[model samples]
Target: MKENYTILAASHISGVPTESIRAWERRYKALTPQRLQNGRRSYSTEDIEKLSLLNKLTHEGHSIGQIASLSTKNLKNLYQKHSPQRHPLAEDLIKHLHDFDMEKISEIIEESKLTLETRSFVLDFAAPILSEVGILVENEKMTIAQEHIISSILRSHFGTLLQISANLKPQKRFIFTTPEGDFHEFGILLCAALCLSRRIGIHYLGPNLPAHELIMATKMLSPKAIILSVARLPKDLQKVDIPTYLKEVRTHTSASIPIFVGGDGYRPRSSADKGIQFLPTLAEFDKMLENFTK
Candidate 1:
């Protein structure tokens, strides 16, 4: 038997804006709420659950357009698969790291199976988890060795995927790297993995690459895009002329090639930069890629 829920009731249950629900129905044919003889739209319980999951995914930085196309079953599958391993492991790993329990840490690492389970783990899982691990180190909850252990496992995991992806398509190459003095490359590696999943051609430059070298590499390879991952700007470097350096690189490259900046350091300072696009997270970056491909 179908259970009926009014628009307001459904909105309350699903946490979706009523207007958004209306728009989804009108634009995407996403949710076809039944019409009563009196002309009010009424949603079923199944509809409510689907809309709830859709709201969760949208809040997680997925596009409404993409979510609209997924079946209820697919949505459930995605949620079930990714929700369990989101950020808790990194937090727990840090706690374990503080205790210096090598045996337990080894057990945790083995249980986490970061390398073994990486293929099935989505980008949403990996990026936040890594970020959490970084925070643990930054907060001194874990020693550098513990962080390195987890990072080494992830590096090997992503490195294997990168190798496999490298063998695929040869079209539209991109070179990804971290800017000068920015040592964080986990985001860059995750981006590489995402590109791999899509079979997009990419050459990863790893971390701590100078701008001049990046420009020179750009001139040599002529990649479709140059992605710079800047996790944090050192205090000394913050005062350095970012615009001047960007302009310097621009002089040597075609104006059409897009330069995308990602990670924490690239967070918006002002709306002044016309040439650079700041991508805050891997999910946001992936959406940009999706739109570009479409």
Candidate 2:
């Protein structure tokens, strides 16, 4: 059961103006608080979190009307993409997510990028921050929607890095993408960033790619390897099983193209495909890139 907070309490905790909250609730339908015995409105924790995000985004120039219909995940991702900058500590970063302090959060990300090399940037700052956020999300201390904001910000950053390094000489050819139904592509994007920093030739086909599409891509491109990301284990293994998909992919491509599977949700079933191999973490993936390309 969730605790219900009064309008004043929600406003205090979320740092939102009471009238503004009421206006948003009425106009945007941003939140639907419960009515008390006296017909007074009361909010839940999730309601406050959602309101906080809405307030932050609107403060950054987003129109409440335009964003009114967005899902929580969509809202967070929107905030991340457009948020401005500030330098912050790890603790500050975590706090900012709840506080919805986009400027300070943006600053910390930009500062990390400016100061660190690609590998250090990823291993030192990106990885640690994400690891902390992941734990919080798992523990229910942080909302999944808010975490997507971090992913969106980093995804934009890494995409730029990959693009900038696109003209560099190729060390090896690879195709990076997530399997169908696994909408999570941040893991592969981060990996591609590291790969690009090393001047490796990478063709990144972003998330939600069906197996047939991959087969077509493999045949057309003829890359040295096909790297499929299993970022989030399929909710239904019967329909979207990684190993099954890997085997199906293997049947379409030549035996020459080695298939690599990875990410947090990657769990090969008991009877797995022989061709598809799993790399447990980015550290392991980095080592493989070093070994394979060298």
RMSD of each: 12.6, 15.9
The sequence of per-residue lDDT tens digits that candidate 2 reaches over residues 87-167 is: 245456778888878998998777777777787677656765676677668768788988999878887888788787677
User: Compared to the true structure, candidate 2 yields what TM-score?
Assistant: 0.64
Model 1 spans > 4 angstroms off = 1-122, 237-240, 269-271
Give each model's whole-structure lDDT: 0.71, 0.75
For residues 135-175, write the lDDT of model 1, one tens digit per residue. 55776756688778767877887788788766777788778
Model 1 lowest lDDT segment of ten: 264-273
Assess every candidate by TM-score: 0.61, 0.64
